[model samples]
Target chain A: MMRNLFERTGEKTLGFLQRLGRASIFLFHVLKGFPIVLTRPKLLLDSLYSVGVLSLLIIVFSALFVGMVISLLGYVTLVDFGAEQSLGVLVALSILRELAPVLTALLYSGRAGSALTAEIGLMKATEQLASIEMMAIDPIRRVITPRFVAGIIAVPLLTLMFMVVGIYSGYLIGHGWLGVDEGSFWAQMQSKVQWNYDILNGLLKGFIFGIAVNWIALFEGYDAVPTSEGVARATTRSVVYSALIVLALDFILTSIMFVEV
Target chain B: MTQAYIEIKDLTFARGQRQIFDGINLEIPQGAITAVMGPSGCGKTTLLRHIGGQLQADSGSVSVAGVQMNGLSRSELFALRKQMGMLFQSGALLTDLNVFENVAFPVREHYQFDESMVRDIVLMKLEIVGLRGAAQLMPSELSGGMARRVALARAIVLDPALMMYDEPFTGLDPITLGNIVTLIRSLSKSLGITSILVSHDINESLSIADYLCVLAEGKVVAQGPVEVVKATASPWLKQFLTGSTEGPVDFHYPATSRANDFHLEAKS
Candidate 1:
């Protein structure tokens, strides 16, 4: 019984390590071949149009609601302290420093990341990738690299858009509706939210989240067993794994970027 | 004997606990049509994959032309693959691309040719398969035979020296099956390409094949010229060729007796 337990544990550990090694190699290939995308701008643009442009509705709607919720939450708390005037700083900092990057990444992982995994997984299952290899074209350079570059570009840009729409919507709800002073709201936000400290760090988070999400996506797809069930499982795994890793890394990056600031 | 165009020596392969190929050896003659025919579960498709370098043997040397498949680097293997073409059972055309682009895929990716050159070559190849009119059609729109023909067109568009077809006649109607068999034989003659076909369509295969190989239970049971195979008297080979399940091939599944397993009284 003890020996069997040891064997099972060892097998599980070996499997996990093998997966990690394969994922690392896949990530290295994506980074190494990333420059190839410059010659193939159309692929990246198409992906951006898919991953970024198509997610616009959800991002805008979510940002608006999230911004209003933050305003409401901040307003309730500030009423206790008699500092409702600080709602501008509260909403601005929350959106720029945290919500924009993290929430945008979560949405992108659910939407674009899942689709990328499914598409590539299906291609692998169908032997289209193998056919590409047989034709002397590198599937990594031809397929995944463009998509990876696009994800990196699109995610950050989408975060910026999210931040913009979100902060303004917060302005409407906090000041336009709740009767926080319009002057004090603008004044407090400008005074408190430093560009380098909040905005740049948030964009950086967006960029890193983009890379992590796509890396997980492409890895899951490439590593998926060539079957319908395998592809389906990998698609779900990509979303779940990408979301968890993005959130986890957001904490680490937030500590490194913001804790110091 | 002259060196074969493709050779496999001491090839052994297994999937999990199931042995697919056991120290198998094969030599495909140059510029000939060779058909590998066997019972349904025999490793015919697996053999083609080993030759294609899609699967590696547990212990063997698979040489294509002069290149040893396992010894080749990733890039080298791909370079070797460029000299070969494979038609899968389902056609395996990229669903995203239309039929013309599917045929044009290999040529366009490999060479820096202009669109016109691609169009001409693609049209010419499609014309051979009688699918030129179906160029703009999606793979989803293609009939099974049409899809296979389009795949054949894609396989040949690069004009590779070797072509592998997996069950080209398995699900085809009689007319389409006849058409595909004729196409394979005619194309082999015209292109002078060595062809390895995996199928169980005995009449069709034997009709077109210069050489025939039969695999059973992870080993080559018989292989020779079509006339020699036709003359052979092995019971295993005869039962297979004659499609008689009552012979060596057990009609009963391998299992404990039904009475013992189900705890039932035996029928008188």
Candidate 2:
């Protein structure tokens, strides 16, 4: 049993290593396919529609709810310290530097990342990628790079949208409903939220999260074992892995961006 | 004998634990439709992929147009692939693209063809496959036969010197099968495209293939002109040709007797 256990563990480790190698190669090809991304405007536009435009409604709603909840909670917490007027400061700092980027990515992973995996995984299973290869067109350039570029551009824009909706919803709750002073809310937000340090870092986190999410998604899809079951599992893995990586990366980025240096 | 366009020498391949091809050697003549026939999982599709450079053979060589396939660079392999085209068993059309764009894909990707030129060329290829009327249809909307025809149109649109069809006639109605066979024959002849067809459908292959190679147990057990392969009395050939279940190709799985499998106590 010990021997069998070792053998199984070894096999899984080797499989993981091999997949890591393939994923690296796939990523390199995608990066190398930058030329194609620039040259093929139609591909990028089409992917933008699918990845960004299609995902608009969900991003909007999730942002609004998250905004409302944060403000309501902030109001409750601040009231105890006689700091309810500081609700705007608290909400802006949390949403701009942390919640907005991370949550938008998590949602995008569920929405666009899984869709990417399913679409490309099905294409792999049906040999559409191979068909493109047999046509002498690089599938990296022809299929993947545009989607990668679109995702990179889309997620950050979506995050910006999320932040806007979240802030407004916070206003509706904190100022309109909770009877917090509207002047104090906007004033604290404007004064406390540093544009360069806070907002820029948030957008930067969104950018990085975009890369990490789509990278995992596209890799899983392209490396899907080319079966129906394999594609389905890959789609599931794409969401799971992208979410995990985005959250982990968000923590790392938060540390770096918020550091004194 | 015609000159060989594709030459495989002492090729060997394996799928994980099981060896699929062992020292298989065959030559396909230029401009002739060569059919590789065997039962399912006999490396027919694998052989096509090997020639297409999608899979690397473990040993020996696969050369098309005198280009060694083993160590070619990515761009070189793609250059080699540009001279060849393959029709997969499932048609493998891009689901997102309609028939016209599917046919136009290769031309659009490889060349700077203008919209008018792209449209004209795509329409012509579709017309050749009798799918011009289906240009607006997506792959999902196409019937199996129509999808295959569209795939064929796509494969030939680039005018590759070599055309490979992997089971082009599987799961088709007889009329559709006949149409495919006629199309394969007529297309190969008119376009001077060397063709390799991997299939189990004996009637369709025999009716269309110019040369024949029959594989069994991971090797080419019989190969010659169609007439010669027909006359050859090799047991493997006979088993394959006659579709017999219980000859050299065993009907039973390689397992113990039913009594032993069931753990019978005694045979009273």
For lDDT, the strongest prediction is 2
Stretches of candidate 1 above 4 Å error? Answer: A1-6, B1-3, B262-268
- Residue-level lDDT for A68 in candidate 2: 96
CAPRI tier of model 1 = medium
Q: What is the TM-score of each candidate against the true structure?
A: 0.95, 0.97
Candidate 2 interface CA RMSD, Å: 0.5
- 10 residues in a row with least lDDT, candidate 1 chain B: B1-10
Q: Which window of 10 residues has the lowest lDDT sum in candidate 2 chain B?
A: B231-240
List the DockQ of the predictions in order: 0.61, 0.91
- Name the regions of candidate 2 deviating beyond 4 angstroms: A1-7, A259-261, B258-268
lDDT of 2 by residue, A6-123 (tens): 9999999999999989999999999999987677798899999999999999999998999999999999999999999889988888898998899999999999999999999989
